[model samples]
Target chain A: MEALFAIAIGTLTSCAVYLLLRARTYPVLLGLTLLSYAVNLFLFASGRLVMASAPLTDQGLERFPDPIPQALVLTAIVIGFGMTALMVVLALRAIHATGGDHVDGGER
Target chain B: MNHLPIVPILLPLIAGSVLLLSTKWSPNARHAFSLAAVVGQLAAASMLFVTVREGPVLVYALGGWAPPFGIVLVVDRLAAALLVLAGIVACASLLYAVARDTETSAQRFLALFQFQLLGIQGAFLTGDLFNLFVFFEVLLIASYALLLHGLTADRVKAALHVVVLNLIGSALFLLGVALIYGVAGTLNFADLARAIPALTSADAPLARTGALLLLVVFALKSALLPLGFWLPRAYGAAAAAVAALFAVLTKVGVYAVLRVYPLAFGPQAGELANVAEAWLLPLALATLAFGALGVLAARSLRIAAGWVVVYSVGSLLVAVALFTEGGYAAAIYYLVHSTLASAALFLVVDLVAGDRTSAGDRLDTADAMPHGALLGSFFFITAAAVAGLPPLSGFVGKVLILDASSGHPAAALIWSSLLGAALVVIVALSRAGSAVFWRTLSPSGGARAPRPSLAALAAPAAILGCIAALVAWGGSATAFAQAVGRDLAKPAVYVDAVLGGGHAQPDDRRRLR
Candidate 1:
């Protein structure tokens, strides 16, 4: 489970980095969304991973599975949703306003 | 009142909501309300400052809940002092807009400006790392809207980059927060401080990763060295008043970096102590050099103002890099001075270019300035203040920073680079001053530039006047800054106020659950 989670995060992060490094706006946005996903997963996995058990500790566990990371990831998701929406509008606005999608608004 | 710590954040939030809801309010009416709200905030911040200066840290847990469970707002000398500064700059920013912009412009500005203020003050006071991230978003989202206000292609382009970059910053911030919480089992600073020392060996690596991630995020936010490419491009394209207000934005990054470095990883950080000291020092010095050279190479005053902000951030990182009492104190003083001076310079840059019909702020010798003498003096005073001229707060602030760096091995490098930055700024400003004002003097012909109304000039003039007063009272302010430094050096005061003994139960996870 840990290896799978690690591989997923690494793959997401690398893809995001590649997309982010692109010269165009949409790719960068896509890259960022992936990056946020990577970060979100990484944050979620920080609670040390739990199986079908509730986020809370069950009948025999010493402590609750740590609801904090769950709460943290939930907040990040909401914020990321707003952030992605804003970026989409901004990229569209940029494209409309500048006639180019290159990150620097295209010197042309 | 007694809820002093939350007022700075709450007032702005309430005022901003009111502004957002009252779509029917006249632009003039909205402007009046916004200005009134900023003044009220100034009053609240001043009250907080006085209370903090005379007493201990003021901790206000939301909903009467306590730290670690309920989010707490911690107002120490550092936060209060920053609040006071933010209040003043905010006032100047709003006033600058109200004075110069039309009613329509004012209508569009109020809610966003207030929201931005809410975020800034929130960042200053928030004791929870997650809360800090939320406030950063609040302020940043407002800044994004404000940045795109005039909607010029250049600004929109710049805003796109800023939004994307900051969005990434947000991701990293969350990433860091999560790792910290996972390792320490809490998101509160006070709790983190306590828990970090006892972290199991296995958690250490994750904690370190979290710390380094946070450092990178802050460095990106503050526009430190290599990560600073987007600043000049974005800030240079922002409106004058917006740019001026943004002087606080970079400082937020500085404040966070300074806070986290010491509290999370400083001496009490136990095994984590001095984890970042190795890289921050050299990077900061290089940032200073980079910013100084950028200032020298800048083509326009507006762009130069952006570089100056970057330069100021560099110097601030120097203070953090020092990681000593004197260093923190010096950073505090420099922080205040740089915010004021940088904001004032950005404003003055606009004023100098306000009346020029062609070559707006290009520092050219072509067109004559409309109010050359008055604007010229504002420019000179602001330039000198920024470059560390005598009898100005910059001079005193730089001396404090240098004094703080006295014993460090990098002292000489910091000094030379600082002095070098100063010299470069002087050259840039002088070249800009002479070309933009002097060379187009009466020797050629009388000035033909249109004069800006007194209203437009008031805010920058008032800001510069404040700098002058600080310069005159330099000694006392320096002393106060030193006191703030000593207070921050001991995080116990902050922790005790927020999560110390009796409040511990209130913050326990069981109660929270």
Candidate 2:
């Protein structure tokens, strides 16, 4: 399970980095979204993986997953969503204004 | 629990919500309301500053939950001083926007402005790492909209860079936070401070990596070299008032560095002591040199001002890199001085550019602008201050920084780089000044530009007056900065106040939940 999680994060981050280095706004936006996903997953796993042990369980439960990282991941997800929406709109506007999708607003 | 610590954050949050809902109101009414809110913030910040001075650190826990578990807001002398600085800049910039009639041109300008304040002040006051990330996003989102407030081709392009870069920065911020939380088992700053020093040797490397990653995020925000290439264009493309307010934005990153590294990884931290010290000074000096070259290479006054902002950050951080009380004190004094100086420069650029028909702030000889003498005087004084000329606050700031670095091993390199940057800046600024004010071509655009209203002049003039006051009251300001430095140098008081000395009932948190 740990290996799978680490591999998933690594793949997402590598892909994100590649896309981020592209010379266009849309790709960069996608890259940012992917990076956020990787980050969110990373934050979620920071508290050590646990199964059948959710927070807010019955009072007599002997063990539970650390709840703080769950809360943090949730917050990260919300903020990431908002940021992605904002970037989508901003990229569209940039493309419209410059009549090109190049990040620098000029032909390469 | 004096509620004043939260006022700076809450006042702006309330004001922004109110302004957001008042879209149907007249511009005058919105402006008046926003101005009142900013004035209230200034008052609260001043009171908070006074209360924290020579007093215990003020801690406010949210929902009565104790630290190492719940979120906390801690205000020491450093945070209080930054709060006041943020307030002063916000007030002046808002006043400038109101007087210049720029606020009415955009939808929800007043609302966004107030939200930006909330983010800045909240970042300053929050004692939780996660909370700081949230506030950073708040400010960045608001700034994104504000940057594109008066939509232009240049602005859109600049916004794309600024937004994308910051988005990447946010991702890194999360990664760093997660790493730190995993290794340290805590997110609250004070708690983390206590948890870090006892890390096992196996965990030390991971925690150090996380700390350094966090530093990278901050450096990116602060516009340290190689990461700051986007700053000039983005800042130049922003509206005058927005740019003025942003003068302190980079300082937020510097504040985080000063707050986090010194406290968590200070002299006492085993293996990670002075984690950032080795890299900070050299990078800072490089950034200063790069900013100087940028200033000389910029094609316009606004872009030059942006580079000056970058230059000031580098200079301020050089002092901070020393990690001594004297170093922190110098950095604090210079931080206040440079924030105001750059802000005043931006406002003055707007005025000068407005007074011309076609010149439009480009650093070129053009038709003589109206009130050239008056605007020229403002530009000259501000330029002198930015270039660290004598008789202004910038000179004093540089001297203090130099004096603080006198005992460092790299004192020679620091002195040469700083002094060289100042000399280059002086030349670049003088050239810009002469191009705009001194070497004027014949009037080209037909109608003469009108003189700016006294109200418009008042804002920038008032900011300049603040700088002059820094000079006038140099003694007291230095003393205050030293006090802040002392407080920062010893984080025990700040830690205790937040984690142990607070009124929160941690045992009841579970039941409440």
Lowest summed lDDT across 10 adjacent residues in model 2 chain B is found at: B504-513
Candidate 1 lDDT, tens digit per residue, B361-457? Answer: 8866666766778888888989998888998888888888889898999788889988888888788778888888877633335455657778778
Segments in model 1 whose C-alpha atoms lie over 4 Å from true places? A55-63, B441-449, B503-513
RMSD of each: 2.4, 2.4
DockQ of each: 0.63, 0.67
Give lDDT tens digits, candidate 2, residues B1-513. Answer: 577788988999999999989978887888889999999999999998888888578888788777767688998889988998998999888988988866433448889999999999999999989999999999999999999988899999999989998988999999999988888777788877777888889999888988998999899999998788889899998999999999989999999999998889898789888999988999999999999989999999999999999999999999999999999999999999999999999999999888878879998778887689999999999998888898999999999999999999999999999999999999999998899998997667588877888878988888889999999999999998898788778888887878775534433433332
Tens digit per residue, CA lDDT, model 2, A2-99: 99999999999999999999978888888888899999999999887877775655677766677788899999999999999998998889878999
Q: What is the interface RMSD of candidate 2, in Å?
A: 3.4
Error of 1 at B208 (Å): 1.3
**What TM-score would candidate 1 get against the native?**
0.95
**Residues A57-80 of candidate 1: C-alpha lDDT, one tens digit per residue:** 666665446677788888888988
Task: Return the interface RMSD of model 1.
Answer: 2.8
User: lDDT score, residue B254, model 1?
Assistant: 91
* Cα-based lDDT at residue B254, candidate 2: 97
Q: What fraction of the native interface does candidate 1 get right in terms of contacts? A: 0.82
